[model samples]
Target: MHPDRYHVTLVLAGRPALHGWWGSEPIARAQFTGLVGRYGQPGTRITLVDEETGATLTEWPETS
Candidate 1:
């Protein structure tokens, strides 16, 4: 796996977030979408980041 790729950080209240990395944006988004579709609720947030620079790439529900 590339060191510089999109990753998902799942935020849950009163619990540590689960982190996973993907090889590309599309795959990451798909995985995240599927996860949220199955288990996410209000206040659940999906964070996307760049593994190499540690920069936050995007956040779900607010694509801007």
Candidate 2:
């Protein structure tokens, strides 16, 4: 991970799903999408957050 890159936190129901840094938002979103595709549950809530700011970047299930 680069020091200048944004850190991403992937969570499912408040538990850590994945963690890493990405050079750009698109790459982070792509990573999030892939993770959900692999480990997402039918009713589970998955979220992507900006680790530095604690802001939610995205969520799974569209309506979640």
Estimate the lDDT of model 1. 0.75
| Overall lDDT per candidate, in order of appearance | 0.75, 0.68
User: What digit string (tens of lDDT, one per residue) describes model 1 on residues 1-64?
Assistant: 6843888878877464788888887888787787677657776787778787788777666655
For each candidate, give its TM-score against the true structure.
Answer: 0.65, 0.58
Q: After superposition, how far is residue 9 of candidate 2 from its true place, in Å?
A: 3.3
lDDT of 2 by residue, 1-64 (tens): 4442555555666677667777677887787788778867764666666666667778776663
Q: What total of clashing residue pairs does each candidate reach?
A: 0, 0
Badly placed stretches (over 4 Å) of model 1 are 1-4, 52-55
